[model samples]
Each structure stands twice: as structure tokens, then as C-alpha cells.
Target: MRAHGDFSRTADRTPGMTVLTVDLVHHPAHSVLTLHGELDFASSDRVPPLIDAVVKAGRRRLVVDTVGLTFCDSRGLRALIHAERALAALGGGMELVNVHGRLLRLLDITGLTGVLAITTGPGAGQAVRK
Candidate 1:
């Protein structure tokens, strides 16, 4: 796997705030994006452009590893949905991995668990459609 640049963004230097970092790893089968820190409104907007670039580069399947993700707000969820849609538009798909805790609960509460592909480990999860 070849690594791409790290995309880290900070909305502020306020105390108790975590910076969002996105690490991209490219493989023959797919591209893996590992997300760290918060995925709130402050950092959500940074994801789509990267996804678009990946698609433009001819990579279709995407795997988002959320093990390092600490928190995600509604806007963050919207960004993820957008990613799925973006990939789906190209006959590709996005999978969320290492999901647990509040984020997992949020997906369940919002009924997104059924809409988005998710797994606790690599190669897990089914492709469920709306």
C-alpha cells in the first residue's frame, strides 16, 4: 500500500478540541482512509473533495476506517452520506470499519446502519441498500 498525504484540519485552538486528520492509503483493490479525531461541522467539509479526487483518479471502492474517530455530529454524518453517494454514482461503494461506541449508536439511532455499509473488522459487513 502506498500512502498519500495527511489531511489535518483544525477549526480552532480552543481547549478540549481535537483536530481532524485523514490519512489516505492506496492499494490495488481500493483506497483506505483512516479518520482521526472529531468529524463535526468544523471538519466535515474536508472529506468530500478528497473523495472526489480519489474518484477522479479512477479509484472506486473506498474503505473508511473509523477506529480513531472520536466524535461525529450531524454534519459529519451528512458528509459521509455524501461520500457514499459520490462513490455510488460511479458504481463504487464506501465501507465504514472499526465502528463502535457513540458513533455506532448514532448510526443505529439515525437508521444509517442499514443505509451505509459498516463492519467491525476488515472484510466484514454486507452491502445493504435503502
Candidate 2:
């Protein structure tokens, strides 16, 4: 179903550019987190709990759609790592889909690309709807 419940701020940080927002889309078997704006220091901290909630609610998979993510830093990486670890411990896991090239490079540099499941199927970002 289509839902617009944001877990973070939606106010524009700049004139026309929003700084960050974390929205949730609940699916039957999974949860889709649509992240917009920068997933840096100010925003990264808000991620892990959401991931935990999905797993806690008995969802086996969580997909982080970063296509709308404009920027991410080490803290963002840490957040993803934390979520991954938590899910693994719970016998569940996460998918980082539609990740951009630059972000992929960051994960590669940090040796996280190997630990996390990344998917880039055709129109993966559009997967949020179905």
C-alpha cells in the first residue's frame, strides 16, 4: 500500500531542497524505507531503530531505497551496518536497493559491499509500489 509516514523531518533545509526525510511503506512480507535528502550525521542516527522495528514486528526483509538519498557519510554506513547486524542476529536481513554509484563506492571502500545484499534489478527504485 502507498503510505507517506515520515520518520524524520520533511521541512526544507534550504530554499527548495529538503535536508533529509525517512518514510515508511509497509508491505506484506517486507518494509520499504524510502530515504530522501542527505543521510549523513543528522539523519543517520534515525535509521537503526526503524530497521529494528521492522524485524521486531516479524518482518523478514527490509529494503532501503536510497535512490532519493542525495548524500551519505560514515555515520550512514554505520547505521546500515548496525541494521544488518541486528537483522542477521534475528535471522532476517536487509536489502540496499537502487543505491547510487558513489554510495556503492563508499560501501566498497569500507568493505561493506560484501557484507550487505545489494540489488540493482531493472527499476528497483520503482519497487516501492509493488
Off by over 4 Å in 2: 1-18, 121-123
Indicate which candidate wins on TM-score.
Answer: 1
Q: Scored by CA lDDT, what does every candidate get?
A: 0.81, 0.77
Instruction: Please give the lDDT score at residue 30 for candidate 2.
Output: 86
Worst 10 residues of 2 by lDDT: 1-10
The candidate maximizing lDDT is 1
- What is the per-residue lDDT of model 2 for residues 47-123, given as tens digits with 9 covering 90 to 100? 87787668666787788898888788888888888888887887878889998778878888888878898876687
Look at candidate 1 and give me any clashing residue pairs.
Answer: none
Candidate 1 segments whose C-alpha is farther than 4 A from its true place: 1-13, 121-130
- TM-scores, in order shown? 0.85, 0.80
Write the residue-wise lDDT of candidate 1 on 15-121 in tens digits: 77887888776666678888889898778888988797778667899888888899999999999999999999999999998898999999999999999988975
